[model samples]
Target chain A: MSSPAEYAPTARTVPTRSRERAAYDAETVHAILDDGYLCHLGFVADGLPVVLPTLYARVGGTLYLHGSTGSRPLRTASDGGLPVCVTATRVDGLVLARSGMHHSINYRSVVAHGTAHRVHDPEERRLALDALVDAVVPGRSADCRPADAKESAQTAVLRLDLAEVSAKVRTGGVNDEPEDADLPHWAGVVPVTTSVGEPVPDPGLAPGTPLPDYLRRFVGA
Target chain B: MSSPAEYAPTARTVPTRSRERAAYDAETVHAILDDGYLCHLGFVADGLPVVLPTLYARVGGTLYLHGSTGSRPLRTASDGGLPVCVTATRVDGLVLARSGMHHSINYRSVVAHGTAHRVHDPEERRLALDALVDAVVPGRSADCRPADAKESAQTAVLRLDLAEVSAKVRTGGVNDEPEDADLPHWAGVVPVTTSVGEPVPDPGLAPGTPLPDYLRRFVGA
Candidate 1:
């Protein structure tokens, strides 16, 4: 995984702080993206920076994001390739250091800089839509009906190439000063985990409709 | 809570899609922000939009984000007021609809557009840093040693007013079409939750060092 051929971080994706935590490997970047269900999408709207939370899925070296046709960001990108920044983060633990200034989070995050273009091809859009659904719960697309023509026409999918991507990860315990370490303060890491609770069946679910096997073992990132 | 004095969403902060989910009350906005300890901060650098995940705490009508003094985004803001967008999202559940196009996540998110400026006042910085630590685990700051002069000097705290903030929330079960409801596909909501596991003590902890009471009751968003 340390092979240099995996990923090449551009200047934009490189971290200006804690460079030791920055990773430029495809494996690391993909793992971080795959582990998370949501991403903060940043784009310039009317020359003002706008960040929106959206669902995303990573398929190989490309990331797919879906929204309604009326979504401002999607509509803006549909006109042409819109320069966008997408970031996915998974907080693994809360680092409680001996000092307030030293408090931090143990997290794995990936920042991607790319141009997002709306997927116009019907076949590709369908595949992207499926990927998005399956990204939430593995094998979910298989258990559900695919979008019909009218539903497909109303949705907008955007694709971003994973060209400029880097993952920054912080792990391990708190880093307290040597002097502060002897203080009576309690310092350690509180592990944070995102997990799926019991599935709530729809009120209108048909009798004897069983919960899908994929959902029973579903674990969020 | 619906009073007009609470929040006034501008054209930029208004939702262009799913307008029903958009919320313009201060209580809603603050609640969403308070529940999450992390936020995706968006700012433009050299004409390119950048989004980074960082720890944040909401104090009154202002949100404080702290980072290394050497961080690019913080340095960029310290020069002058930098237009920034901060977004926090919590995925409550995965809404699996009968059709792929209707798939969505039940989430609560707040998108705030404001200008962030570095906090230079020492007293304010201390208060903000304390709020940040306590934000992760309630009453954590009291149990931890305060930041020393040198540590505070090296850190950069940016304050963004929560004036132009709005929360968008999506809840409830799958909204499948009546026609597709009869499809054999299974549809429901898988609840997602972020929880705190048992605290991991530091390897170098001194003998008789007890786990703090705050961590025992810690509950993540």
Candidate 2:
């Protein structure tokens, strides 16, 4: 029996190495997934694997991927569902250790294994498009012009359920072996975070329009 | 005959959508790959695609990936070269437009399609290991204790040639339609950059040891 709050471990979700770092709890998975807008979507093409970086949004138990109608993965998915793996990582710090072999990265990542299906239903596609816009900026979907029928037809929205998901997170400072602790090396962690710079307005933006409130809020966050 | 300065694009290297964003020049690909230490490596496993985020280093035309001997990818490569895809992306900014469908991320990404092979030569393996350490912090390889024989044997180094590679980059501001320019929504770009926090020294550092000069240089970079 599996608990509602935690994803049940399957053969694919379990890590063969670093077993301690894998987290199947919903909190960890959702937190890692929501932190980034970019994901590397992987799928097999002609018996060879291909990975492409693209934008994605997560709503409830589903992950929505944004891509073009002509994209190979999207076209394959539209015909029927295609097996896909989505991975997103948030690098928190660089952990410098006393030995080159011990150096590691402090990061939180989510890897989802499932089949990706194109969202054909009109209402779900509409909502998924909005979610993709908001994924980049909070409340951004409402501020933008809605897609017309022609525009909607050109875009492809892929949906993958978040059932087989796992997150692996590494934190804290260097983990030098006891014997190597006194080495001359300067060992520690350099924390990393995403910093937003001053927003650059479009050259033809309306003359007096102010920066949106949500953007300011995003900057503050 | 192909130019020496640029990689010749194959059928898979070309983009089906937004063809203008693709570049096959060596300069563009190297710049994007050097800016980040993490990469998503994709390979087919059990006839399904698997994408795992891992640390990588580039040396000339070869990219080195570090992993444990027990790792599936490394094990498979050790037996015989396996088809693989490696992708690294650097998010430059968020491009907000007047329409939801037009919003796009300002990013530079390199997607390489190739096969991965395990490093068996001792001298090459040693050099690749040093490159991997320096990839995280420049000049870091010399600062740390060198890996001993046992440690070296336990670590697996996978090499992938950067031949079939393409870099896609999007920069500058939003591309809102001329007709939608007057929409009240604010359209602009929020520049994104990696910010490094103060270095946190390890709890077990020697009493009089000072922070290394290389780490300071990394912070400035």
Candidate 3:
């Protein structure tokens, strides 16, 4: 399989701490972003920092965020491109070190800095919304009905080009110092994973509506 | 059990979209925050929005963020209080709808807007660091070695008061339209849960050091 191209790090995308954990490869960045279903969208609101959790989908080199037409961030972006920072993180494990100072979490995260603009084109908005659905469940877009004209008009899709992005990852066992190796404290990694539980059918679902194959085999980050 | 006090809504914390999902009760906000181990910390840097995922712990009305003394954000906060927005989110399920527009995720999220100041008091810093370790695994602090003077000196802790906070939650099945109920599409909620897997021992762990009970019964968000 062909790998994604690497992204060159700009001054802004370069992390200041733990430079070894920072990855500029597109493959690494996309993998972390794709595996995550939610992103924290950051923007300046009234000159104050504001971060909001929202559903997101990645298509090609762009990230699409779902929001209501009346959402403040979407409206602000529609007026003019809104400078935004989007972050997605997955905690893989808890690193229990011998000392409190060395304790950390094993995680994979991507941070993207760019301007988000509202997607207004009818066809593009439709495709973006469909990608979002499929992002959550592969092949879900094809199984579901397409949005009608009014529904499309009511939803707001913000697109942010993945021009400045970087991924940070921490893995492996605890990093306790050799001096404390024999401290009798258990030092290791407790793996953490997101699992998909049984699907709960809607109360009004038609009888005998079997669970789809896609969801039956679904796995989350 | 005593319930957590509610925080009054300010114009900033009020969500423009999904007003019904916004919760002002401190219990809801604290529960969401406590259940999450990672948070996306947002701030403005050089007139651009930046969001970074980091480890954090909540103690009563304060959220303590783990950082290094050399970290940029910590250094900036040490100079003066840094305006920050911290957000924690836990995805509960994927809501599949008959139409793409109605697809959403069931999640619990909290957003706190405040200033984070560098924690300077040594005693409080030690307690905060211990709380952080215990936050990951209950009773972990007592099981592990405490940080030495030099280690504590090198670690930076930032504290943000849990003021101007609000929790937003979306639960239940997909809210598909009545007209699309019989569309022959799969519509339901696929529950998502974070599970703690088998603990992995460090390769150099001392022989006969048994896994701690706290880790054996760990349950992550």
Candidate 4:
């Protein structure tokens, strides 16, 4: 793996000492982001740190995030072009073992550092906002309504450039000790996976509207 | 809401004009941590930043995290007593709408700041290690064989004091425009929940060995 240990932001702000796993190159970082659906954003509020989990999408070298204009963080960031750190992660599987100490999970994740700038231009905001929509359901954006003036006014969109980012991943099976390997304890990966179930039709859908193929083919993250 | 808009970390992290959500006291902070099962750990590596999702458990004012000794991040941090930033999040529901632009998700999250220290004492290491095990599945440690010296040596434990932490959350109904609210568009929370299904017994388990209550009652995060 191409580790970018030297490029990660290391301030008192970030305290993890696992330098090697704490940072990675753009390729690794983008791969993790492409596979995940959500991100947790970190920023300062009143001198303390606040983390918020929100829907996000990656476009080229930047991440776009948005929420209600009424949201405190979004409202504030949108108004002042505040800097916010965002992170995305996906849990792949669960490792079960004969010993509690050896049990673990397999996962992939990305963390990025940058300032969030509000997207105010009509066209850019429209496009940026659609990234979020597309992220959850790729082709659904074209099928849905574009934000009208009033709706656009009520939403806040912030853009964070992916200038600095990294990814850390762990995979594979149990690592039982030589002596314990034959101790009659069942040890293996339980393989936890996310799968989408049958979609519930909208109670108010017009009589003959069929389910969208994109939605029907949906698979859980 | 005691919005401490002038906190230190917040001042450093948040741009001058960003609106940070309310500052949380220990009570509120701990509540979010206790309620959520997973955390996104942020750290800088190779000059870039990365985030990873992992299970976490909080006891009093401290958070305990563990991973394989071979894991690069854990190994590097254990070697230098480096501090790491950890975050946890929970999604309450998915807000679907008549229009994609108005759709959103409801969520809660917590972020903690601390310098992770490697647990060297055998007894504390064992206990701290078990805390992680129990966090994933209560009573799992007792049900399984204890980690032998070799197995214990293959794992690494990091301790983080949950002193500087904060939580930002958003919840409610969709923000549909007045014009679109009654446009015959179905709007409401679809209600996404994480729930555990039936457990599959290990193939080699003794024929009549009943499933442990913890494993059987497991709730997905």
lDDT of 1 by residue, B7-82 (tens): 8878877787788999998888888988977999998877878898878998888899978898888888888888
lDDT of candidate 3 over B3-122, digit per residue (tens)? 359988999888887889999998888889888778899988877788888778889889999888887788889988989999999999999888888888899989989999999998
- Where does model 1 exceed 4 Å of error? A1-5, A219-221, B1-5, B219-221
lDDT of 2 by residue, A61-115 (tens): 8999999999999999988798999999999999999998889999999999999
Give the alpha-carbon lDDT of every model.
0.85, 0.90, 0.86, 0.64
Give TM-scores of the second chain, every candidate: 0.95, 0.96, 0.95, 0.81
Model 4: residues with Cα > 4 Å off, grouped in runs: A1-31, A44-48, A67-84, A99-101, A197-210, A219-221, B1-36, B42-54, B60-62, B67-86, B111-125, B143-175, B184-221
> How well does candidate 4 score on lDDT at residue A68?
69
Which residue runs of candidate 2 sit more than 4 Å off their true CA positions?
A1-3, B1-4
Task: Note the DockQ of each predicted structure.
Answer: 0.81, 0.88, 0.82, 0.20
**C-alpha TM-scores of all predictions:** 0.95, 0.97, 0.95, 0.69
- Deviation of model 1 at B184, angstroms: 1.0
For candidate 1, lDDT tens digit of each residue in A1-221?
A: 12244678777766777889999888888889988768999998766788988889888888999788988888888887889999999999998887776778899999989899999999888889888988888899988888888888888899998888889999998888787878777778888888888777787888777776776667422
lDDT of 4 by residue, A58-135 (tens): 887778887667666776776667656687776665666776666766667676776688888898888887788778
On TM-score, the leading prediction is: 2
Error of 1 at B109 (Å): 0.3
TM-score, prediction 2:
0.97
Model 2: lDDT equals 0.90
